[model samples]
Target: MAVAPLLVFMGAAFGLPAIAIATGAFTTSADAPGGVRWTLSNLTTSVHGAYLTALWGSVRLSALSALLATVLGVPLAQAVVTSGSRALRDAVMSASGVLANFGGVPLAFAFVATLGNAGVLTTRLHLAARGWSLYSFWGLVVVYLYFLLPLMVLTIAPALEGLRAGWREAARNNGATSWQFWRHVALPVLAPSLLGGYVLLFGSAFAAYATAAAMVGSSVPLLTSQIADALSGNVLVGQGNVALALSVDMVVVAGAVMAVYVPLQRRSARWLA
Candidate 1:
């Protein structure tokens, strides 16, 4: 009974919107005034040069940020999980909890304050003369890392915790070095979790908008920012529909992530067993 209402609510809200936009994408408006007419033209136009470029940029940025987050976050998670002191462990866990929920415009402002031209370190006497700017592509990568890494940590840390300490002790008793212990015992158990975590990180990075828009001011041509700009104009003219197409592109990418994620989830389950 509870499931029925949830399904009905979802269908009426998310499912209906998706169906409408999908229908609108292929078919233009003839009966509905200036609305899109149903044909291949709208989708073809949507798939053209600029949209493709933005899609590629979104994919590349997502991949790089996810990779960086995995590299940094996995280590931090391991440290947090392996820490001896309960207080230290709780503090680190608390910090990760805080970071997971921290996002949107305020996070962007925090980055700008710390890394902007007039920022603390940038404006300090020693660094001010070098003329560094954190508002460019590299800067965006930096900010993207800030958002995705903590999520990565949370995703993989549980897998790390599940690794049996006895296995590590057994390896150590056999004269295995720390590297060898991880190499032979821990890594095999953790690989599937890492892959799944990467998918989540990539998805999060690809969908991010507020931070990018706030930091770079939309000239950077991110797909999310493009969608935002498209929606900002006349609602009746329905240029907003173009943003819907962009959103469809996002849904397609997310579906691709799921394609990879489900198999990896099975693999992780097998590894755990």
Candidate 2:
């Protein structure tokens, strides 16, 4: 009974909407006397042409952004974990928490103000002359990094903390060089956690909508943007079903990512346990 309210809230907020979308994805738009008929056309339509292109673009963007975030974030996390000052660690973690949640229109506006053609930095530094455009694919990557980097740091920080200092000390006692210790011991231990964090970052970038929409509109042709376009009647009159089908595709991708991540996370937990 204590969890009843929570269950009800979940059902209403997530379960109901998901059920609606799943049913709608398989429902036809034909005006029969009773209601819509079951059809697979929406799923077929969602996997071809512009929709396919958008899905592929989103996958590439998410993969690249997550890869960059992982490359940069792991070292930053290690530095924080090994820092001598508690104040600095606290400050960094606090700032990371704020930055990780800082996305959407406000973040988009901030990027525009700082990197757009008429932006202060652009105007002062003449970045346009350098062939820098803020409304392109690379620009979206920069914008995504704003949050993804911090999110990576936050995700991996706990895992870094979970690493035993004794392991490093034991490696040092055995005359293992820094590179050797990391390559053999430390990295193997952290591999699962690191991969889990990377997958989390990938999903974060994949599901992103507001920042992309606010920055590039439809110029970049991301899956989330295409889904929005379908639902908003911008692309076609009766594409709501198609939009639902695309959403299901996104869910499938997310499920596959988590399927891989859950085992890694469990392995990491076993190490910590």
What are the Cα lDDT values of the candidates? 0.80, 0.93
lDDT of 1 by residue, 1-273 (tens): 869999999999989989987876667555556754556665565567777777887888899989999999999988888887789778877777788778889988997888788887777654546756678777788888876888888888778888887898899899999999889778877888899999989998998888888888765767887777667862235556666777788889999998998898788877766
In terms of lDDT, model 2 sits at 0.93
When summed lDDT is taken over every stretch of 10 residues in candidate 2, the lowest stretch is 28-37
Among the numbered candidates, top lDDT falls to 2
Candidate 2: how large is its RMSD?
A: 1.5
Top candidate when judged by TM-score against the true structure: 2
TM-score of each: 0.89, 0.96
Q: What is the C-alpha RMSD of each candidate to the true structure, in Å?
A: 2.7, 1.5
User: For model 2, which pairs clash?
Assistant: none
